[model samples]
Target: MTTERKAARLPVFDRAAATPEQEAVLDEILSGPRGNLAGPFLAWIASPELAEHAQRLGAFCRYSTGLPLRLSELAILITAVQWRAQAEWQIHYPIAIDAGVSADVAQALLEGRRPVFVDTDEALIYDFAVELYGAKRVSDMTFAKAEERFGHETTVNLVGLLGYYALVAMTLNVFAMRANEDEPLPFNE
Candidate 1:
């Protein structure tokens, strides 16, 4: 049986007829490290002010975070799984692989299985994200482990990164944003 896809709740930002504020915001994002306005930005552009702040926070979380790319991307994937956010998973899966997370790990996550993390740091990050999402707070012991392994600054940055990606996931889900028609959906749900 074929299923009809619902239309996106918001208008995808059109740069041609954009307002001055939209143009400026789009320009800022386009020139940033993330050259393309993919994922959340497609909906965020409608609210230029929110887009600016969210994109800035996202840039810092994605690029300037103290955690290594592998761990940061892992945290992002964890958030994607938690929220069932296909856009987040699709965009980050390749980056995560290149950053050292194995296909096994990504596959397990997408399958809702417990991924056997060979990297101790990946395991620690997975635990941290699980607690943060499941319990709404990390245990003191988990926090201590993260702080010990990553130091206070990096640990704090890891927490910030998870929160930022959760925001991204929510935005994509809210707008029903997704990958191209030809791209397979990451989650079966």
Candidate 2:
């Protein structure tokens, strides 16, 4: 048997050829906060069922999470950097900064450096996300601090948010989907 390489397939969503299921999912995505069909949705629509579920989860993680948007965006940025998902990074970086994540911290992450966080909450979030990615589990100390600060429901939401964004990152990377090809890449050379 010949070896088959898994070449990168860029997301190319064509509206006219969409199946009924894809059309339904596309409608949901379009009517939501994201008014356009770009990013992971283009890749995800291939499996309309997965697209439907993931989009719901994404909406909850992005919009209804108990953690503030600032913290949620920070976690998303961390996930983006961890996955080296250029599209994810490019999309969320501005949102993170606008939601109160410091420019210095964002820059440091882009450069793959440990940032000196100014806010205690930002530090805690960074530590939590970093430890989770590094060790594949959060240390007890890290978990306790997160629990004490945010409580059970919100902490779960944080984890869920991390998970949802991770899915997004993977989809983006695998499909070679980019938010804007004209824009500079977020990672260092």
Candidate 3:
């Protein structure tokens, strides 16, 4: 029974079988600028029960534009780190860089260090990410401040972004997704 429990604790990716749809999703994601995609991401999308909804959620959370794209990416990056999701962090760190996030800041967040060049806005968002992910609740002060600084639409978008990547982080970690060798991690792989 102990051995069975131990085996159950292992990641699902070890037993994942790639279907045609899974390969297609992986191909699409890898075809993006990053040029490398993790297998677990594709596996999640390939599961018919989760695929369509995952696609919608991914698009709405990441690609939908309104709030500063950079900040949204940064928030997601920070959430990935707080979750200790190496695969999710690896996937988004480059996207954050492409969106104008600095390599130093990315490294700092990944290494459990406070970011140096964080602006007031970025810092507020980071605080929100930490609080939300760590405690699963946002303080009233944080909500008020975010509302005042970013306005309601952006605030809503921020929440959605957080929810989106949090789900991704869980899936990636549970699957133990491997980072593609073709695309190295930011700030030293």
Best by the lDDT measure = 1
lDDT of 1 by residue, 55-156 (tens): 999999998888889888999999999999988998899999999999999999888887998889999999999899999999999999999999999888
Best by TM-score: 1
Candidate 3's error at 106, in angstroms? 1.2
| Candidate 2's TM-score | 0.92
lDDT of 2 at 16: 78
Residue-by-residue lDDT tens digits, candidate 3, 40-158:
44446437447546655666777774667788889988987876766677667777899888899888897889898657888898888888888899999999999999888878888
| C-alpha lDDT of all candidate models, in order | 0.87, 0.85, 0.70
Q: For residues 46-91, could you state the per-residue lDDT of candidate 2 as single tens digits?
A: 8999999989899999998898899999999999999999889988
> Could you tell which candidate, 1 or 2, scores higher by lDDT?
1
Clashing pairs in 1: none
What are the TM-scores, per candidate, against the unseen true structure?
A: 0.94, 0.92, 0.74
Q: Give the winner by lDDT: 1 or 3.
A: 1
Candidate 3 wrong stretches, greater than 4 Å: 1-40, 181-189
Candidate 2's C-alpha lDDT? 0.85
